[model samples]
Target: MHSSVIATQCTGAVISQRERQTDRDKEIVLQIRGHHIAKLDPLGISSADLDDKDPPELLYSHYAFEEADMDRIFKLPSTTFIGGKEKSLSLREILHRLENAYCRHIGVEFMFINSLEQCNWIRQKLESPGITELTNDEKRLILARLTRATGFEAFLARKWSSEKRFGLEGCEILIPAMKQVIDKSTELGVESIVMGMPHRGRLNVLANVCRKPLEQIFTQFAALESADDGSGDVKYHLGTYIERLNRVTNKNIRLAVVANPSHLEAVDPVVQGKTRAEQFYRGDGEGKKVMSIILHGDAAFAGQGIVYETFHLSDLPDYTTHGTIHIVANNQIGFTTDPRHSRSSPYCTAQPLFTTFTRTRLIHVYTPPSHALTVLSLACYHQSRQPHAISFSESLTLGHPVALIVLDEVCSHM
Candidate 1:
């Protein structure tokens, strides 16, 4: 009788452990499905057509799970899962984290991508808690970069106050944003990057990103004709080529900024052609060695037909440059007209998606210090096989610290 009782007890223990494991798995599956459904954007639907909704939870009644079990699983700060560490959290903490991950300074829209792997990769980066926290060294680097961008603009205003230059006064962070793209691409084995942009911030990019000498840039402002033949173009319309060592990755890379005409977005196709030629010469069958970056203004990107034409050529085997990183500096105003008067759709980035059905990723950065820029850079180089577009919501009338003050005021009003 004693032996039989002991065997029965062992069998009961095994059954109990299996039940617990099954329950945990069910909860995980339900949470994943619910989160995915919640994030899907219903295109062409107005907010008025939708009813008020509560926190999303699985309505499937077959599984027995508590309200606490349905709470989404996120990587909470100070909670280590290593060595079977238990994650114990209150309901409030879980809700707070949910808000932080999806509603913070960085916003991503990638659900339209047909590939499950691509969607999940973007979801993991954005939904993981505490991923936006920056190290002390990174903070210092951002500050230094911002100083260089602002100082360059400030110096121009002081010295050549009367010159007719299209300055990057309010949107200085774009300088560092471009550098981040170059650094990340170089680290990911891209040896050459050809880029094209409008005249708005060309002088600053030539000085900083292409490493053009300050003396050469300043000479353009001087009241004199060019001494060198074929150097007759204006400062911002000029092109640059530099092969230099990228200090961050310890790699030598080639950079070329294609010369653009007065028609701002005409350089879009030129950049693609140059990048494709380079890839062909280098025998980059899969476009692992050469890439391109194209910068667009909010007005030109939405109004220009060439932008649409270039996006359609992305998938053609002969014309494809593997991928291009498009950065749209949206000031929310097209020239002097507001978006309310200009665009029928809400965002400029959505135009290509609606028309061409291009497989692209869209990320919006509301603040300069957010990780969206890094995420955008990484997505382009890591995927290295598809096109990506990222739009920055910046101010035309206000810049950094002042913009912070404006934010505070707007928040107070809210």
Candidate 2:
């Protein structure tokens, strides 16, 4: 054998080995993706048939590989919880971790983030087992918040059964979800949060989340003469400013829900402008001290033109509020149209967030109310870095007549 021939054979052998390793990595990545689809569609009526059957197995490998193979070949971090703590990697463990992260409650849509750093950060936060677990006290707090939200709506219905109050009926979870965002932002050193939302749940948000005075809100329900010089809008179309201490964070915080008119998405720019001004006044160049939270209706989020226009402002040097937390309270029905008819895109919020060059992270939550609140809190933690959007697409019970009208329209269309 010639020396040159030996060298060529050796090089060929090394190349073959590298190719095998690359093929193995690709297979593992595909398997990880399968974990996301393991469960049936929680909200889909079609999935009711599969409810009794065990969730179909997505991992074909059958957990045959050992721990060493996982660390060397999988490459992804381990988030498997065996005994309430993160454990070492294995083929079986990886499947468990991916299931907990992606399949259980929340389905995070951050693979399109474009930045490897951001993607990995989300994986770590969400993929890590026990990351979404809340303490007993925290769970109790959420329950209390939910109770207040439900009770307020119930009272309003009895008080004004025939009146046109755009109450938060089906999407009562939104109140606790918004509170979670505020609480998490406060923990991250945010002193002021400027929020904007449509009329669907403005009064509930005003009463519970903003902690507006009960007397002031009750007075608005009256049909008396205008207290202000100008003609007043509907109660739900109103906004309030409250500066109070966040008892949870023990920090003084300012909460302002910007008033929006019947034009559902017109307040988006106003919220951004308010957030940007606060950042400027406080010299929060990085938007650490001030942030914005914009809430949108599912139909308006996709159908409205201003939602896209406001997103374009996020990356502008002068107009950017560093990052804004967008929460879409998707009841799956528009003012008069169903989501299937109104939204061409899969997610109403996804298109607007990704249409611009801005790096926006979206989390599509399909969890129960309690788990939904916890997942929302995790989503808010990433907002200060860049714009983040969370869509809570859970089915809500619509008790109001207007929501019933929307539902009737949906059923008729069906």
Task: Please name the candidate that would achieve the greatest TM-score relative to the true structure.
Answer: 2
lDDT of 1: 0.60
Model 1, span 124-233: residue lDDT tens: 56546557678998788777887898789878877886675677755677888899889988998899999999977788888888887677778788956543224788
Candidate 2: stretches off by over 4 Å: 1-42, 45-87, 225-231, 352-356, 367-414
Q: Indicate the worst ten consecutive residues by lDDT in candidate 1.
A: 1-10
| TM-score of each model, in listed order | 0.71, 0.74
* Clashing residue pairs found in predicted model 2: none
lDDT of 2 by residue, 22-121 (tens): 4345333532332244332333432221223322233333323334444332323232222235323333444455556665556555554566666666
| Model 1 / residue 146 / CA error / Å | 1.0
lDDT at position 162, candidate 1 = 64
Where is model 2 poorest over a 10-residue stretch in terms of lDDT?
1-10
